[model samples]
Structure formats: C-alpha cells, structure tokens
Target: MAGLACAGQLAAAGHRPLVLDKGRGIGGRMATRRVEIAGQACGFDHGAQYFTIRDPEFRMALSPLADAIAPWDDGGSEPRFVGRPGMSSLPKAMAEGIDLRQGVEVLALRRDGSAWLLETKGGLVMARHLVMTMPAPQAARLLGRDHPLVPRLDCVRMAPCLTLMAAFPGAAPRPFLHHSSGTDPLAWIAQDSSKPGRHAGLTCWVAQADPDWSAGHLEEAPDSLVRLMLPLLAKTIGAEPEMALHASAHRWRYARVTTPLGTPCLADEDGTLWLGGDWCLGARVEAAWQSGTALAKALTRHLHAG
Candidate 1:
C-alpha cells in the first residue's frame, strides 16, 4: 500500500518513479490467494482482511477506482471497506500506470556519486532518489545499522501473523461475519465468503492467530501451522476438519505495526533516500497511504527546489 501510494502520487505529479518488489505480484500484505476446490476457484484474503477509509484524500483517491472497492459490513460502526473480488484488486488498480518491476530483489544499496545504486539479482539499477517502503526491519537491514536512517527504525516494532485459510461445503454454519478474541489462540476469524463480490460456492474462512501465538510458532512449517490452526477454526465455526475442501497457512513476518515511528517518513540529509511504510503511523491502510503520500509530497518539493 505504501509503495503503491507513493508511486501513484509521484506519477500523478509527472514524475516517473520505479517500484521494485521481490514478490511475483502486486500488493504485499493486501494479498489474495486463489485455490481450486471441487473444480471451483475460490479466493481468500489471507493478508489484510479489511481496511477503513478515514482520510479524505484516501477516499478521494479511491473514488476513481470505485468499481474495485466494496463496503464490508463487518457489523462494525466505522464502515469498513474492502477491495472487490479480492483484497489485491485495489492495489492492482493503484498500480495501473506505475512502472513496477516484481521479482527483483535488492541485495545491497550503495551511493554512486550523485545517485543511489541498488544491487538487485537482475543487476544494478540506479536512481537519483530511492524510497524504501518495505517493513522497517527490512529497510533497516538493507541500509545497515550504521546508516543514519536505521536508527529511526529502531523505535518501530512490528508483529508477525499466522493466518489459516480453509474452505468447506456451502452448508457450514455461518455464525458471524467476523469474530475477534483477545485470549484465544485464534484471535480473528472471518467468513471470507460473506464479503461482497466473493464466490459463494464454498464457505471460506480466514483465521489469524494472536500476536503471542504467532510469535511462538513463527518458525514452524506451513503444513504444521495448518494442522495446528485448522481444528481451532473448525471448532469455532462448528464445522468438521475433515469436511474442508482446501486448507493452507501463510506467515507474515511483519504483519502489524505494534509501535509506529510516529512520523510520516524518514529521509537522509541529501533527501535522495527515504523510508516509509505502515510503521510510520498506525496499522491501518489509511496510515500507509498517508505516509506514502506525505513522503511523495516531500520528495516533490525537494526535487522542485533542486
């Protein structure tokens, strides 16, 4: 969300900003996983379940892509919104005119005279200005501890998340749209199928473990995590584990920002390198958009001044 937001705004300002990601597709945490069960294709929003639009600019930014957005009546009062069909839809739409190169991993970062050189697996790519929109720890590691920007990231802390996606027959019990528990190992469980624009053929459920539980089993294998979380979800939803048509687990190392940097973004003395993400503010999607947008505006001013 942060990377795409920054890139989108920069592009709108008539600047060509290049976005490189190691993942094969767009939308880092706002992801959707597709699976075939009983020959029916189903999607699970295993990453970010839903997002709320409190910022006016965010609402305006999404107005142009209304077709890809939907209201998720999670019984919440604040009016939550989700990407239609899948959570990845919004990010994919936001990436429409941006120059994004996926599957390009940056191994190292170095200053080459007036520009920044990124040593990616594909080779070196140079940029007069560089923005690191990844998680704080990842950006810190890439910049090394000695880098000035790294110190600012030390105050930011993120928590991991272990999510389980399971699909069962359509007759499974629909207890609630979403359930959250602080003490339960499975902290959050939502009926992914109940959301707008989702396939109704199968009953899909997305379960996320609490931070403590997730951190404890962070190193476990995917299959092991699935085995551990499947029964818990089945019990909560009043379904049998054997009745599941498809089941999988995903681990997000830095899923939620527990302690944010309390700022919009960070930049070096030269204003050539920058760091920003959801960790800059709260964990909401709006925070990422705000951080990225703020960073882009600052960068625009700097470029114009030069």
Candidate 2:
C-alpha cells in the first residue's frame, strides 16, 4: 500500500515509477486466499482484517473503488471500511495501470555512479532515485549490517503474527463477527465468511496469535502450527475440529509496528534515497498511505528545488 500510494501520487504528477514485490501478488499484509474444498470455493482474508479511513485524502483516493470498498459494521469507534471480495482487492485497486513487477525480490542495493543499483535474483535494476517502503528491519538489511541508518532505526520495533485460516462445513458457531482477546492464544478471530463479497459456502475463520505467542512459535512448521491452533479455534468458536474442511497457517515476521519512526520519512542528505512505510507513522493502512503520499510530495519538492 505504501509503495502503491507513493507511486500513484508520483504518476499523478507525471512521474512514472515502477513497483517490485517479492510476493506472488500485491498487498503485502492486505492478503487473501481462495481454496477448493468439498466442491466449495472457500476464501480467507488471512492478513489485515479491516481498515479505517480518517484522512479525507484517503477517502477521496478510495472513492473510485466504489463497491469494491464497503463499510463493515464491526461496531468500531467509527466506520470500518474493508476491501470487498478480499482484503487484497484494496492494493489491486490502488495499483491500477501502474508498472508493477510481482514475484521479484530485490536481493541487495548499492550505489552505482549517480544512480541506485538494486540487485535482484533476476537481474540488476538502476534508478536515479529510490524510495524503500519495506519494514525498518528490511530496509536496514538492504543498507548493510552497519550502515548509519541502522542506529537511527533502533527505536522502530515490529511484532510477528501467526495466523490460522480454517473452513468448516455447515453453519459453524459465529458468536461474533470479530473478536480480540489479548490473553488468549488466539488473540484475534474473525469470521471471514461474514465479510462482504466473500465466497459463502463453508464457515471461514481467521485467527491470529498475539505477538508473544507468535514470536515463540515463529519458526514452527506450518502444519504443526495449524494443528496447534485449530483446536483452540474450535473450542473458542464451538466448531468441531474434525469438521474443518481446510486448515492452514501463515507467519508474518513483521506483522505490526510496536514502535514507529514518528516522522513521515527518512532521506539521505541529497534527498535521493528515502525510506518510508506504516512504521513511519502508525500501524494502519491510512498511515502507510499518508507516509507514501507525503514522501512523494517531499521528493517532488526536493527534485524541483534541485
């Protein structure tokens, strides 16, 4: 989202930018999955469950998505907007007509003459300017082990998340649409089938382990993790584990920002190399978008001045 938002603003200003993602598709945390079970099309929004828009600019930016973005009445402090069909739909919408490369991971970054050379498994990519929107830790890795930026990024901390996606045949007990229990092994649980535009057949559920639990089982095997979580989910939601048609687990090493940068972006002395993301502001889609948009505007101003 941060990359897409930054690129979108730059493109709107007549500066075309290319986006590269290591994932199979867009929407890093805003992810979704579809599986076939018992001749049913089951879906799970395994990452971000929902997003709220407070910034007017974000609302304006999202207005074009129309029905793809809908108000989810989850009884929050304010209106909660979620991407229809699946959470990934939001990033897919933002990336419309933009130059995007999926399944390509940038292995390293180096300074080459007046441009930044990005080394990937496929080949090398060169750019006059660079904006890295990955997590602070990831950005640090690209900058090398002992770069000056590493010390500055020490304050930024992120937590991991272990997610379980399960599908149950027939009407599984849905005590609530969404529930968060910081004390329980399953810290957050959401009935994915209740979300708007999701495929309705089996009762789909997404459960997330709290940061502590996720960290403990960070390296656990997916099948083993799923085995450990499914029974807890069944006990919580009153579903039979044996009736689960599909069950899987995913681990997010940098799931949420525990400590933020408290700024929109960090840039080199020349303002050509920059870093920004949700961690720059807060842990929300709105924050990521704002950081990206703000960084683009800042880069535009700096370039014009140069």
Candidate 3:
C-alpha cells in the first residue's frame, strides 16, 4: 500500500515509478489467506486486524478508495477500514495501474554512476530514483556500507509477534472480545470467523503473543505453542475449541513499530533514492500512506530542482 501510494504521487507529478516486493502478493502486512475445511474455504486476515486514520492528508487520499474500505466497528470513534472483499483487496486496488512486481527479492543496492542499481533475485533493475518501503533491518541488509543514508534510519525499531489461528466445529459461546495478558506470553486474542465474510458454522480464533514472549519462544514447536495457548483462549472466550480444521502459525519479525523516526521519510545522499514505511511516521495504514506521500513530494521537489 505504501509503495503504491508513493508510485501514485510520483506518477501524478509526471515521474515514472515501479514497486517490487519479495512476497507473492502485494500488501506487506495487510495480509489475508484462504483456508479450506471440509471443502469449505474461509478468508482470514491474520496480519493486521484493523487500521485507524489519524492524518487528514491520508484520509483525503483514501476518500477515493472509500468504497473498497469499510468501517471495522472496533468501538473507536475513528472508523477503521478493511478491504471490501478481503484485506489484500485494498492494496491490489492501489496498485491498479502501477508497475508492480511480486516474487522479486532485492539483494543489494549500489551506485552505478549517476543512477542506482537495484540487484534482486531476478536481475538488476536500474533507476535514477529508488524508494525502499521495507523494514529498517531488511533495508539495512540490502544497503550494506554503500549508502550513507543508513545511519539516519536508526530511529526505526520493530517487534516480533506470533499469531496462532484455529478453527472449531460449533459456534463460540460469546461474541469476540480482545484479550490482554497482564504478564503472560499472550497479548491479544480475536475471533476470526466473527469478522465479516466468515463461515457461519466454523468458529475461528486468532492469538498474538506479546513481544517478550514471542522472542523467548520463537523456536518452539507449533503444536506445543498451540497447546499452551488454547486454555488461555478458552478462558477468555468461554468455550473450548473443537476440531482443529485450519490451524497455522505466523511469525511477524517486524510486527509493529516501537518508536518512529519522526521524519515522514528518508532520502539518499544524492537525492535520487528515498525510503518510506510505517516506521518512518507511525505504524498503521494511514501512517504508511503518509510516509509514501511525503517521500513522493520530496522526490518531486528534488527532481524539479535538478
């Protein structure tokens, strides 16, 4: 979504832009998956549950895509938007006309004279301007010591999150409620099937462990972790989960931003490369869009001056 926003703003200002992602699909953290049980399929958004809008600029940008975005009704004054059909639909909508390439992992970035060379698993993509929307640690790995902009990116930090999803046969005892553990490993739990577009018969649940717990037990077996978590979930939701139709675990290495860089975005020494992400501003969909917009504006001014 951030890359698409940046590309949109740049294209509107008459500059060409391209977006590359290592995953098979767009929407970095706003992810969704299709799990089948007894020939029935369910769509679940296990990565980011919901997003809040705090910036007017981002709200303005999202107005056009409002039809695709909807209110989440999470007991907040500000409305949270989800993709109309699924979570990934919004990012796909933003990337409509842009040059987006998936399954391309960027390996290293180096200066090739006046231009920059982006080496990836596929091949080298050359561009006069580059915008990296990846997390700080992943970006630092690709940057190495060639880019002077690395040090400026120190303010960004991401925590880990372990998400566990399970499916049961019968209806849950009560409606979904967010659960927090005072000092336990689990931080939050939600009922996935309770959300929109879920199967009526199947009960779905999502559990996210706190940062400290996730870090400590990062290497634990999936079954063991699930066994340890089911009781807590049962206690919180007031029902014991039955047949485990769709059970899986997802580990988010860069789950959420702890402290933002405070800057809207970052640019290279030569003013030809830019960096933007949720961590650059705040960790949310709106912040991601804001960072991208800010980077696009900065790039526009830099290109015009040159």
TM-score of every candidate: 0.98, 0.97, 0.92
**CA deviation > 4 Å runs, candidate 2:** 178-182
What is the TM-score of candidate 2? Answer: 0.97
Runs in model 1 lying further than 4 Å from the true structure = 171-173
Better of 2 and 3 by lDDT: 2
Evaluation by TM-score, superior candidate among 2 and 3: 2
- Tell me the spans in candidate 3 whose CA falls farther than 4 Å from its real position: 221-224
lDDT scores for all predictions?
Answer: 0.92, 0.87, 0.79
Looking at candidate 3, the ten consecutive residues that score lowest on lDDT are: 234-243
Give a tens-digit lDDT track for model 2, residues 121-228. Answer: 999999999999988999988898776677767789999999999988876454546465656878888888878887776789999999999999999999999999
Cα shift from native, residue 128, model 3 (Å): 1.1
Q: Candidate 2's C-alpha lDDT? A: 0.87
Q: Evaluate residue 15 in candidate 3 and report its C-alpha lDDT on the 0 to 100 scale.
A: 76
Would you list the rank order by TM-score, best first? Answer: 1, 2, 3
Say which prediction, candidate 1 or candidate 3, comes out ahead on TM-score.
1
